[model samples]
Target: MERENAPVGPGDVVALVDGSFFMHRTYHLAASGDPARNLRPSDGFPNGAIRKFCERLLGFLEAGFGGTRPSHLGIFFDHSRRSHRSELFPGYKANRPEPPADLEALKPLFRDAVRAFGYGCIEAENYEADDLIATYATAASARGAHVLMVGSDKDLLQLVGPTVFAFDFEYGVPGRSGYRPARLFDAAAVAAAWEGTPPERLGDVLALMGDQTDNVPGVPGIGMKTAAKLVAEYGDLETLLANADAIKQPGRRDALLAHAETARLSRRLVELERNAPMPVPLDDLLLGWPDPDVLFPFVNAMEFSWLGRKLGQLYQVEASSYPSDPRFAAPVAGSGAAGLQALRYDAVLPAEGAPPFASDTAHCAVSAMPLSMAHIDGWLRFDFRSPDLRAEPGQGHEGWKIHVSVDPGRVAAAWDAILPIVAEARLQAKVAGPALAGRLGDSSHRQAGKMLVLYAETAPDVGRWRAVLTRVEEALDKAGVTPGPRVAGDR
Candidate 1:
C-alpha cells in the first residue's frame, strides 16, 4: 500500500465498504441498547451508525490485511428502497418492514461523513451497495489491485477470487475480550461456507434455494445443501434445470421442473451487476491524508472526543481546540507550512494546562492517555466482562463514564433518552444485575431482571461525575427508568 499521495498503481490494495449493510445493522443493534449505537450530537441527529462506520474505516485503514494497507478505499451505499431487482421482481425484499425513520434520516449524512475523511462515497440510482461494490471491485481488480470488500452480505462473495476478498468490520467482537480480525473469504473460503458451492456458482445454488429474506422465488422444495449438490452435479443452474428429470430424487426433480423459469429469475436477482455507473473516478479514491481543518470540527461536533484525540495525534493538532460545532471547512488555498503552523498553535491549549469545557457542570480536565483514563475503572466492578463495556476516556469532563442501573426491560425503550448523554458525554456502559435471555428485539416485553450499567471516563471527582449523572437521570426519567438505590461504593 503506497499511500504517499500518489496514483493507485498495480498491486495496490483497494477496500470497498458496504455502507448500507453496516448502517441498517447498527440501527438494529442500537435500538436494542447496544452501547456502540448511542452516539447523538447536540443537535440530536442520529450519528451512532455513522460514527461506528467511520471508526471501522479507521480501523481498516490502520489494520490492513497481512501487513498490507489499502491504498484506495470507497464507501458504497444503496441509492433508494428500490433497485433493478425490485423492478425485475416486485416481491424482492418485500418481507422487510419499513425502515426506521432515524435510519432514513441518517442516510444523507453518509456521503458527507465519508467525504470529510477524504474517501469516495459511491452510489447508483437503481443499484445497491453490493452492485456498486461489484462494479468497483471489478474495475480495480482489472487494474491489478487486490480488492477487499468490507461487508457481511453473502451476495458479495460472488466477487471473491484470487484478486478479491470479503469480510465484515466490527468495533468489538461478540463475547470476545479483545480485537478479533475478521475472516477474509477468497474463492475457496466462500465455497467452504456454501457447502462446496464455489463463488462463481453461488448464484446457481441460490437460484434453486429461494432466499426468503429477499423474497426471491426459487424451486420451492430445494434448500442450500440440495441446491449445492445439484449445482455441483450439473455444473450450472441452466443445465440442472434442463435435466431435472435425470435427478433420481422425484421430489427434487419435480420441483425443479415446475419452477425452471422461476429459478432463472432467482439467479438474476442474486447476480451482481458489474457495470453500474461509477459515481467518481477510481483514481479519486486513492488514499490521501485527511485535512485537519475539516476533520477536527466534524468529529468534535459529533462529540466523538476519543476519535478526535486519536486523529489529532495522527495529524499533530489538538482536535478539541477547534470549534465544537461541526463544519466541513474548505482547505485554505496553498496554506503552506506557515499557515498550518498557525492552525496548530490555535489548536494548542493554554500554557496553564487545559481549558475547562464551557458546558454547564463540565469542570474537570483529564489526560486522554490510556493510563490516566484507567482511573475511572476503579469506580466499580461489573457483572459481565465484555469488550463493549469498556470506557474510552477523553480529554475533558465530558470524556468520562458513569455506571447506573435501569431495569433491563426498559433499556431499549429508554435508549432514545439515554443516547444524547452517551454521545455528548462520550460515555460507555454495561448490563449488570441479571442476565437477559431470549431475543433482544423483544426486550421491551421481556421481564428481565438485569440492570443496565452506563459508564464513562474523564470525571476527575464525585462532583463532576454526579453532574454527568444528573443529565443521565433526566434522560432516563423521561423514559420512566427511575434511579434505584445507590450501590455501596457509589460516592
Candidate 2:
C-alpha cells in the first residue's frame, strides 16, 4: 500500500466502487455467450458482471478512458445480509428479492478482481456498499483528494460536492448510443439531475418523492416534480414538514401532514452514512496497477482471454499459449455453452490419493489467501462412477496427457489450458476456486502428470474444508456438465 513520493490531495483521484450495485446488471449480461464481446469463447460459463467489472476497471487503471487515472481506489462490497438501515426499518430495500443465482455465484470473482489488482476491499458486517462509499468519499475529501463514487445508486447523489463526485459509467455508456463511456457528476451536475435542488438536499427530495423500489412511502400523492419543488422551496424535509400548514395545494398539504413520519423515515433511509466503521485504512486503499502474478491467472481462469492477454502485455508476462501448442486445445463444452464456462479436458490420472486442487480433478475447488501466493492449498474430490472415467461407460480414458514447461508461470498456464475440459467421457475439469493465487508454492505443486482422479466412492465432501468451498460447489452445476451415465459401485 506504500507509495513512495506519491502526490496526495488535489490531483489524487480516488474511485470508491459499489460492488453489489453491479450484480443486477451482471445477471442480465451473463445470459450472453460473450459478456465482454471479446472473441466470444462460448464455454457456457457466464460471469458477465464480473468480466465487465474486471475489464473496465483494468482499463480505467490503464488510463484507457480519457482521464488522469485514479491514484487511490477502494472497491466496497456489501456482504452483510442486512444493513443498519434495514435493521431500523425492516422493510427498507425488502422489496428486492434475493440476488439472482448467477450473481450470487460470481460474487467471489468480483472481490477477486479487486484483490488481483492489488486494491483494498472494504466490507462491513452492518453497513451497505453505499455507506462505505460515503465513508471513503468523506475521508478522501477531508484530505483534499478528489473522490469519485463509482455507482448509479441515486441515494448516493447526496454525497456529491466539490471534492466528491458520482460516476455512473454503466448507464451513461448506454446514453452515448450504447458506447461504453464514463459519466461523472459533480455538485452542479447532481443539482441539475435533481431539478435544481442542491446535492445536500437530495435525500430530502427523495424523502418527499417516496422510493417505490425501497418501499419507503413518501408523502401520499406527491410526485417527483412536486417533491423537487417542495424541497427547492423549503430546503429540507424537516422544514417542509415544519411549515406544511403554509402549503398551497390542499391535497399536497394534507399529504404532507399525514405522512410526515414517513417522510422523516425515508429521509433517514436515503441519507448516506458519512461515517461507518471502515474495513480498511485510507492509506491501505491507495491504488496501483494490477499485480501480474495474481491478475494473469485469474483473468485466464475467468476466461477473459482478452483481458488476460492485455494484462500479460501490461505486466510484460506470457499468459496465452500459441494456438498450435500441442497441450492447448479448444474448450470441450457441449454445444451451445457460454465460452467462459468451457474448460479443456485431459485424461491425466494422478498417483492414488492426491489432494484437491483448482485444476486437478473432474470437479475442483481452489482457494488461497486473498492476494498472497502463500501456501496455495485446496483439495479436489473426484466423483468417478468408477476407478476410471471414460467417454463410453465400460471403457477407459483414451490416454493421459502430461505437460511440462520450465517456468512455473508458463507451466501453470499450459496446465490451465489442458485441465478444464470435462464435458465429455474423458472427464473434463470444471475449475471453481480462488483462481487468483499465482505462482503457487512450487515445492507443493502437483505435476500435471500426477493429478488424482477422485472416483465417486473415494470422493469425500471436501466442501467441509471451507464455507467458501461449499459455495464454490454451486458454480459447477450437474446440468451444466455433460452428465455421464452413473454406474453405482463402479469405483
Q: Determine which window of 10 residues in candidate 2 has minimal summed lDDT.
A: 322-331
Colliding residue pairs in candidate 1:
399-457, 400-456, 400-457, 401-455, 401-456, 401-457, 402-455, 402-456, 434-450
| Best candidate, lDDT | 1
Sliding window of 10 residues with minimal summed lDDT for model 1: 359-368
Q: Residue 163 lDDT in model 1?
A: 90
Q: Rate the local accuracy (lDDT) of all candidates.
A: 0.64, 0.58
37-121: candidate 2 lDDT, tens digit per residue: 5233544455556677776677667762236567877777775456788877999878887765445545555666676677776
CA-only RMSD, every prediction: 18.6, 14.0
TM-score of each: 0.63, 0.64
lDDT of 1 at 367: 22
Off by over 4 Å in 1: 1-7, 34-46, 65-67, 170-181, 324-491
